[model samples]
Target chain A: MAIHALIFDVFGTLLDWHGGVAREASRLLAPVRPDIDGGAFARAWRDRYQPAMEPVRRGERAWTDLDTLHAEGLDGVLAQFGVEGLTPEIKRELVLAWHRLDAWPEVPAALTRLRGGFLLAPCSNAHVRLAIAHARRNALPWDAILGAEFARDYKPKPAVYLRAAEALGLPPGEVMMVAAHTSDLVAAAGCGLATAHIARPDENGPGTGEAAPAAPVDVAASDLADLARRLGC
Target chain B: MAIHALIFDVFGTLLDWHGGVAREASRLLAPVRPDIDGGAFARAWRDRYQPAMEPVRRGERAWTDLDTLHAEGLDGVLAQFGVEGLTPEIKRELVLAWHRLDAWPEVPAALTRLRGGFLLAPCSNAHVRLAIAHARRNALPWDAILGAEFARDYKPKPAVYLRAAEALGLPPGEVMMVAAHTSDLVAAAGCGLATAHIARPDENGPGTGEAAPAAPVDVAASDLADLARRLGC
Candidate 1:
């Protein structure tokens, strides 16, 4: 089947969330808690991401958006670092760090090219608000923002991929899931969508992310530009 | 309160749906039903729009997307016209006329100017798929596709406005609802959103649509360009 649209994993695939979060955390914490390590704090907060969504995924909790999850996780991370006396405004600003992430340089130009050929959207765990904020800062040129909130579920779930394709008005076969993570690709593949893995060698941190797919995928490229080229964008 | 975003009423405010639908209906039916009046057919089809949604709007029926609604409406329209023998493909193509509308000439440039300072989205009764299709055809620079499907309800219902504001992650006061219709503007204002009315003198047909607000609006303009100027875009 012809691929008519590409639904993306925003955090790892498009934006440098780990670095952005680390930078924001450091900028905010350095003035108050000199001993706090921003990288460690970012990693610790990220570590709670999937676990936070687990309850919603398992139906153990009602649908909760990522903002709440990040806010809750931030409290735990701040406590884990023994940091104190931060203002509520600071916490709110810190949670918004995910929205202010820098794109992975080549992503925008490649997206400009790809937009000419296919409908593009972010099928991420981030809600529509975060998607708009991310696109505003990065100028990502999205046709729409899809995934989590529409599905009311998170990644690695069939609903996210299925509902995203449905939202794009395409069958799963005509919608390709583009991500840096193999788990997202596998889940999309299981839903009959095509999959592309854009390698992000440092999505987690420098050298911590995959330089190649950890599992089978139909297409794999060094970055979004490479993926665009391979897809003849 | 500052308006951080502008959510549009896609059909009349941004797109020339009546003209586009009339043209499409004429193009298809002129070759078949020689006696059919395209404008009348377009008006008849649009006349069904509100009533079809009444059951869904009143909660007498489950949520139904516009495509399904339009398809059903098309069946009634064809029968009403005493026309028959349209293939399923032609019927499907006819239904997609809603997705292939031409934007009002000044709307895009005005939108481009407005986009620099505020996020833009279509808060139409349109579902995500229809929004994507409309945006693809017009290159309307939407930050996200929002409205009906998200609210599981149609316009004039407070849920649609309230949920769209929630999805944009802003209070209703910070999001301006822009429409050519007083009903939509009134509904949105009741939900605490700021409202702007753009006069579309020919939205329904020549001299048929509103040349000015029939009800009070926060701002009223000759067209989208005038609206942009008043908004300091």
Candidate 2:
């Protein structure tokens, strides 16, 4: 069977998380600290993402969804920046910034076209609720939400990729994992899923590293529109 | 937070599954047997649904998605109706009739309205792929797909209702189960979720059984549009 579904890595692959979060953080926190660099704060918070999930991934802690993880990590980032006296309501709103990220300009149109031919969903590290909220806000048009929470483990885990394919009743080979992150694609490929890498050059920031697949991907494109075209959508 | 999401029972609640399936069956099988009653054939096939899933629900057999169950049950229905010589391709297509079901006339508009206020999804026993197909065909606009496949268990099981709530990151009380079936509402109420009953008087063919709440529900309406109104969407 040909690839029947395409699962995406949401944060950078579908939505511009760094820019969205940074923008929100700046808007919310600028009054508190004039010296705060919102972009750096966003980077700092996201930098903790992998390490925060490591304990759960290694079985050192019980599984926790990404929303809880994001909230917990936010506290440390706030303290690190010496930003304090924020009310619980503000903190809650800030935590939800991840759920309000804007999709890349090409995403909605590309997904709409791709959806006509293949099932589209987010196979992100974000929890289901986060995925749902983000999809609603950004109009991602996912057929389903499958992610770290659904698999009860974070990405780069074989189970996450395998279980997502299983949930779609598709063999791994028939499900393509589309991600801007080379590591996600590599991990998905390891689990027998086909891979597509759509580069998001500004995912990290202007001067940061660009993702190149460590291993060959079935398709590599400049963005989701390019990916959609490459996939013959 | 008062019903953050409304999870629906898809087949009878959202789509006119019986009518749609019957119509498809009549179109596909009338050539072989002029006497074949398509509505009766649809009812007979659906009649086998619960019994087919009992083993899986009871742990007597490993989990099998509704698509496979429908296929297996179709063989018996074909034999029961004295229809034969259908190719594997034809049977496969017939089994997929469940996916191409037409939504009740009010479904799309009501869902679009409700979508503005709440996260909406089909908490059907249908597999994720089936749900995806149905949504694409009918423009159901589900925020996420959750059901038997996600829970690895069928409806009326507390696990199904509870897990759906969990996936939304909401407490059971904040998630409402909307169904045309009283039994599904009762089960959802038992799990501390609110319930809404949208009557599908023709669900089992006219005058067969009008679904009435065996227990008190949060809302009861003549149809999905009525339900949307009662829910203040």
Candidate 3:
């Protein structure tokens, strides 16, 4: 069967998470802690993301959605920065910052083009609610939301990729995983799906890293627009 | 919180399944069984739909998506009508007719309006792939595909409605269930979700049955456009 669907890695692939999170943090924390470096705070919070999910992935902890994990991680980041006295409601609003990330400049148009020829969805580690909020905010034209909640596990766990493919009623070979990260593409390829890499050098910060795939991939593009053109969409 | 999401019952509510299936049957069966009444044949196949799901719902059989159930039902309908000798490839093509359904005339515009104000998805009995195909063909703007596959069970089952709400991280009362079927609304209400009814008088053929709510609902409208207007969208 030919490739009929394209599942994307959401965080750094479609949206500019670093800028969005840092902006939200600045806006939210400015009133209480004007001296805090919002960008540093955002990075510190995100740095814990992988470790937060490890327990669930290892089956040492029961399944929990990313929203809850983000909330827990936010508390530790706040304490690490010596910030305190925030009300529960304020903390809750801040933790939902992930849902408000803005899409990269080329995303909406690229998605609209690719959608003409293939099914599109987010195969991210984010929970369903987070995915829905991001799509609504960014006008992402996804056919469906497939992620951690649907599979009850995070990505790079083979179950996540397999479940997404199964949900589309396609063999792994008939689906392509499109991402900026090599590890995500590698895991997807290991599950028999095709892989495409789109670079996002600023995903971590300028000059800190290049979003090139560490391993060879089937296709490499400068961005989603280039990917769309390469795919002949 | 106010209702933040609206989950729709797709088959009769958004898409004209009756007309779509009847037309596809007429086109596909014309060469093989010219004497068969396509509309009646379509209804016969649909009539077996509920019965086919009973075993899975009852746990007597393992979970199977609607596509497989529909295929099995197609076989029985073919036998009942004395139609035979369809090649496996032809049968597969015929089974996919469900994915090609056209939306009721008002659906796309109304959904566009609704999508502006609320998160939207299909809480249908269809499988995930079937739902995605229907959305693409009909231009229905679903935020996510939540149906049988998500719950691993068919609708009218409390788990289906509850799980759909849970996946969105919203309490039952914060999600509204919109449908043309009274049974579906009733089940959703039982799960503590608000219900809205949209009349689809021709769902079972004009004048044969009215798609009125069997019990009181939060709101009622003649069509999706009317529903969107009533919701202040």
Candidate of highest lDDT: 1
Q: Give candidate 3 misplaced runs (Cα > 4 Å).
A: none
lDDT of 2 by residue, B174-199 (tens): 99999988889999999999999988
The candidate that achieves the highest TM-score relative to the unseen native structure: 3
User: What is the DockQ (computed on Cα atoms) for candidate 1?
Assistant: 0.83
- Each candidate's DockQ: 0.83, 0.82, 0.85
Who is ahead in lDDT, 2 or 3? Answer: 3
In model 2, where do residues sit more than 4 Å from their true spots? none
Q: Interface root mean square deviation of every model, in Å?
A: 1.1, 1.1, 0.7
- State which candidate, 1 or 3, has the greater TM-score: 3
- Model 1: per-residue lDDT, tens digit, A1-233? 59999999998789988889999999988889877777888899999999999999998887789899999999999999998889999999899888789998998899999998998999999999999888888889898888898888888889999988888878999999999989889999999999999988878777888899988888999999998898898
Residue range B167-214, candidate 1, lDDT tens digits: 888999999999999889999999999999988888888888888888
Report residue B89 deviation for candidate 1 (angstroms): 2.2
Model 3 agreement with the true structure over A98-168: per-residue lDDT tens digits: 88899999999999999998888899999888998898889899888886888889989999998899998
Give the residue spans of candidate 1 off by over 4 A.
Answer: none
TM-scores of all models? 0.96, 0.95, 0.97
lDDT of each: 0.90, 0.87, 0.89
In model 1, residue pairs whose N, Cα or C atoms come closer than 3 Å (at least 3 residues apart or on different chains), thus clashing, are none
As for TM-score, the candidate ahead, 1 or 2, is: 1
Task: Output the lDDT of residue A225, model 1.
Answer: 92
